[model samples]
Target: MASLAGCLTGEEESENTLEVLHGWTGGDGAEAADALFSAFEEEHSDVDLNNKPIGGGGNENLDQTVSTRLNSGDPPSAFAGWPGSNLEQYDGVLGDIQSDVWEEAGLEDAHVEEAVEACQFDDGYSAVPIGSHRMNDLFYNVGVLEDAGVDPESLDDVDALIDALGTIESETDATPLAMSLEAWAILQTWTVVMLSTQGYDAYMSFIEGDGDESAVRDTFETLEELLSNYINDDAASVGFTEVNQDIMSGDAAFIHEGNWVAGAYINEDLEYGEEWDAIRYPGTEDMYGLHIDSFIYPGDNPSPEATATFLRFAGGETAQVAFNQYKGSIPTRSDVSTEEFNDYLTETIEDFEAASEKPPTLAHGLAVDQSTQSSLEDVLNNNFADPFDVDAATAGFMDAI
Candidate 1:
């Protein structure tokens, strides 16, 4: 069987059409995929690209489909994913991207090095670093902050941010913080809070395939503090889409989410950098905003041509800027000019750079494999529900991992 690399390169019978698969289905997902495909078509007029977006609402179904396909000796030319420990699963279906081009693209050496080392299977570069979605960003309404007599930037620490949310809730009859109770959204939001307060060392240990009980316990304790202050009584009842609407309509004062919220705001024709702004979740000042998108090349099947083209384009500065701007993610290549990005994005980039200057906290999903990821999600779900038993939750989590 020809590898994805060979398929990408036209080594096999010219399948000029590149079939890119992802889990983005509707809403912002559709917008993001459309932006990338449109850019690809504009650039490579000769290549017919088919962006096969399979699932919606953070689709796990499509992820399963793609994984099943890859494991069954079939894989797309390139697939969207997050780079982390799980790249080990697809042992040899990636193509090696050239080192020189990577450097030339102005990808910070550390970012490239991390992706290469962590995402690599055995052969070479397992995946190209696409734009990153900072998971821990908190979006809030400026009026809400002003009405509460609080400075938006004052939320640099966890305790301060919680107090601010509480004050805002008390002063205005609005929900202080709005979040959907959906499993993934809850888990991702909590994961951000956990990573921020618990410190990168512990977060990285868990992400790097180590299950540190103390780290998990600390994270949970911090989450308990945060949940006590922020989450509203009706949290368990609302969906993410409704949560987004609440935030947009100013019914909720704050939302902890990824960069895509900006895109969602844009789609709603809501004013940004004025009505609202985004900040890295409180206490992440020393951490790089979490990087949440990955594209891995299969090593065993080796589609050198296709893989090369895909990696080159995926990592290139032009593609990075275009995709990220429309998708509302930070560009992977730091060299690209983000002048068009609003104040919130600029502030996020500044924070990310500062965090990088220290050390990085790997996204929890990246640090751990699928099994551990599932376990953590389950633990988080139970914790988010009632009867908040920290010990039982921690015990169940530690045992599962």
Candidate 2:
């Protein structure tokens, strides 16, 4: 691991410095980001890389920080962002990168087709993807499940999951489910429940403004029940990281989070399949809840060539594999082998490939625009704070979009 000073300093200062802003400042995410930049700096010895990480929280915090920087006219040369509607917000400011960077890296054939397509905006490709995360992962402490006499493979849907939760609650003192009260985390749980109950097409249609209202209400109601019945009582005071601790310590049985949890577990030297294991969120086996972390060049970048080089490196095999390996995400490139990854990632790769439908995740800023996402978040936060009201929550969700 090289220090930040080493990344920015050299005998002869490089001709250009690429300033990159991203939100991977903790745990394995930080380590992976650092490794990528270090490799990039080594390969392009004459180019200096200034890696700026916004560390307060997750994507929402990073988005706010990036927004502040952009508004203040101090945008970085390049920054990490999501695909789909999220990228649309920076349309004019984000460089295409497809013609200049993607081709140069030979990523068209190297990357997964869907992953590449997700980066494309109406105008053109607005970003370069580094990895793909399955947002609908349900991770559990293997020992906890075993102690509770629960069969990990037998829990397939919401009902079975509830029964297992009951067993865990009755047989062991562990919290049946670990969750965070963070707006995004709550929304993630809500989205998974909605997808599970309403089915894939309906879930997509509802988010897009044309689906069954009854189904939506039912999903909300079920989510409320699940939260009220199964989650730890102190969830409101904790964040996802704390919930992760609950899982690792056997204080909680399950956590419905993205694959990033795998990275955290790996960083702690917890073995996959032994200490922790993952499965698709119940009833989501046929679907891939997609989350992609990508980089985009800001329009005001001072060094286009340097930024282009950085994007090229990010999308290439060497950098993508190196980054995702530590980051606990599958490489965005379909051609990349999983030999370096753990068993968990190998299983995720298979799931990502076998899924019949792939939908963007609302929690991670892919399914909707910022305004809609914010509106929905407000409703979800309100619902999480108060007693569940299916009618009221459904109405609020309808109004959000």
Candidate 3:
């Protein structure tokens, strides 16, 4: 793992300074970014890479930060973010780098087709995907589950999951589920619940503005049940990292988060499939919730060539493997072998490859535009803050879309 503290060092008056901004402040995310930037700097010593990391709870704050910079006409050379409709917001100021970088690096042929398509818009590619993450994951503390006499494999559906939660709550002192108060965090759990109960197509229909009203109500009711009963008492005050700490300390039993938690566990030297275990978020066995972390070049970049150089390096096989190795994600490029990844990531890749239905993660800016995402987040946050009526919450959610 590399350190971000002293990674940026070069001539003060370097001819080309690539100001790269991203949201990876600590743990494997930061280490992966640092290692990528360090390697790029070593290869291109003449270009000063000013890598700026904007840390927040998750993509919520970082999205606002990057949007502010771009809207203010002071965007960085390139920034890390999600692909798809999220980048469409900056289409006016985003450069089409498919030809300049991806094609130049021969990524069109080497990368995964879905990953390449994620970066592509009506006109051209707006971003370069570095890795792909499975958003629907239920990570558990192996010791805690064993102590509670619960077999995770036997828990396959919502009812079984709830039963397991009750068992853990009764047989042990551990928190049943670990989660954060952040709207996105809450939304992640809710989305999984929705997909589990309503199925992927129904969930997508709701996201697309038409779906069963009963299903929507049921989803909210499920969220209310989980928040009101199953989760940790301090969930409202904790963040994802703190929840991870609770799991590590045996204070919490399971965390419904993305695979990035695996990176944190790996950073702590915890063995995957041993200290911690991962399962598809209940009822999502046939579905793959996708969250892609990618880099986009701002159209107003003063150093386009230098930025292009960095972008090219980021999408290459070596950088993708290096970064995703610690980030707990698989490379977006199919050319990269899974042999270098851990057993957990290998399983994620296999699941990703075999999933019958792959849907964009609602919490991660894949399913909606920025405004809608914010509005939906506000609704979820308000409801979570004070358990709201399912009918009222459903009405509010429909209005948000």
Residue by residue across 1-401, what tens digits does model 2's lDDT show?
Answer: 98554666452234277888888988658888887888898888867678888875566677887888887877788888887777767756666677888777788888888777778876677788989889888999999999999997897889898999999999999999998877788788888988887888888898788867788788888887888899988877777887889888989999998888888897788988888998788899888899888887777666778888888888988888788888888898888878888888888888889999888898777789877888888887786554666788888888786
Clashes counted in candidate 1 amount to 19
Error of 3 at 178 (Å): 0.6
Where does candidate 3 clash, by residue pair? none
- Considering lDDT, which of the candidate structures 1 and 2 is the better prediction for this target? 2
lDDT of 1: 0.67
Candidate 3 per-residue lDDT over residues 27-95, each given as its tens digit:
658888877787788888877778889888776567788889888988788888888777767768887
Can you give the lDDT of residue 365 in candidate 2?
A: 70
User: Could you tell me the TM-score of candidate 2?
Assistant: 0.94
Q: Which stretches of candidate 1 lie over 4 Å from their true place?
A: 1-14, 92-118, 205-215, 232-234, 237-239, 267-269, 299-307, 356-364, 382-384
Candidates ranked, most accurate by lDDT first: 3, 2, 1
- Per-residue lDDT tens digits of candidate 1, residues 237-307? 77666677777877878888777877777656667778877767777755665555766665443344544
lDDT of 3 at 166: 94
